[model samples]
Target: MLTIPKELPAGFEAYGRSTDFTPDNLPARLQAAHSTKAGTWGLLHVLEGKILYQLEAPFEGEQLAAAGEKIVIESEVPHRVKFVERGRFFVEFYRKAELTPG
Candidate 1:
């Protein structure tokens, strides 16, 4: 099932830069549905409006992330995010373990 992390896990560090998505231009993978790295995490912060985040099977459900709210994505978890209204958001990738941890 989809879950909400109260805070970031220990040792988790930003792997890449934060990404912004708007109603006008959204990534194809994020739109079509995709998963993150095996040890990669994602934090979606909604700056304005609302977003509809969906998870794949085994944890099939939709989450509403509004302004001032955020969602923590598990590593390798199949999921996708969508814009509920005209707004913007950013996703910060993290690596809780190590960059090359297996």
Candidate 2:
């Protein structure tokens, strides 16, 4: 069984998130191999059912995430997801937290 990383890289903070998506409502871009922008990361949170997460090229592998679980996405890594069962999930984007001058 493939193990999914549960934690995001240190210093990164959540910047945004996608609306919850189900099998019938998932976008084609997400169903096909794609990647996060440079310096950005993503966390796929499964809210219901299960999803198949697949990585491409240098990170080639796959894993299944069920309700209440999350999969960490590395920056610039090609990856995609498919519904394994009736599922609902969303991707939360992250980036290094900018230091603010006090």
Candidate 3:
């Protein structure tokens, strides 16, 4: 039960609402995947328990995270995540309009 931002700008879209899961209640050999729309970014925050995540790109970083840790990644940046313990959390997906001028 968390309130997430729903405000989106032009060329940006939110594919779906935030998702929550409990590790203790999840079946073994389970993994969740979300596809990102082009020109978009995704954010995931751990509100409880711990988890391990790895981004299959230059943003690669792996470690165990406890409550209050957050991870942000851009679209097409393949990543994998696993729950370390039974807990609650939220994941948000957002799209960006344009790339910043280099």
Candidate 4:
């Protein structure tokens, strides 16, 4: 049950960035991700094992996000270390400036 975000507003496109932290020494695919600093928004999905989502500071929140579950967050938010997972996961970055008014 993979859930993807709805389409962005007019003139906005999904900008994606991906990095594989799966190790060569291990049989598991483990990766961790942090959002971009350019005032972007993103969604992270775990295509294999489970993941943990953590928020820093006054946010004081944490959740055990699972495979096929998508988490959305703003880049500028104080939250950090959003996800730590094992297996395939990808992120798509979005920004308000990318959207053009009709």
lDDT winner: 2
- lDDT tens readout by residue for model 2, 1-102: 333466888999999999999988999998898998999999999999999999876665888989998989888878889998997999999999999999
Q: What are the lDDT figures for the candidates, one per model?
A: 0.81, 0.89, 0.61, 0.52
The residue pairs that clash in candidate 2, if any, are none
Worst 10 residues of 4 by lDDT: 22-31
Instruction: Return the lDDT, model 2, position 49.
Output: 97
Assess the local accuracy of residue 80 in candidate 1 as a C-alpha lDDT between 0 and 100: 84
The 10-residue segment with the lowest total lDDT in model 1: 1-10
Candidate 2 all-Cα RMSD: 2.3
Per-residue lDDT tens digits for candidate 3, residues 30-76, read 25443355677766678898877665443545656689976654565
Off by over 4 Å in 4: 1-12, 21-35, 80-85, 97-102
Which residue runs does candidate 3 get wrong by more than 4 Å?
1-16, 24-35, 57-60, 97-102
For model 3, state the Cα shift of residue 59 in Å.
7.3
Better of 1 and 2 by lDDT: 2
Q: Give candidates' CA RMSD values in order.
A: 3.6, 2.3, 8.6, 6.7
Give candidate 2 regions above 4 Å deviation.
1-4
Give the candidate order by descending lDDT: 2, 1, 3, 4
What is the overall TM-score of model 4 with all chains considered together? Answer: 0.59
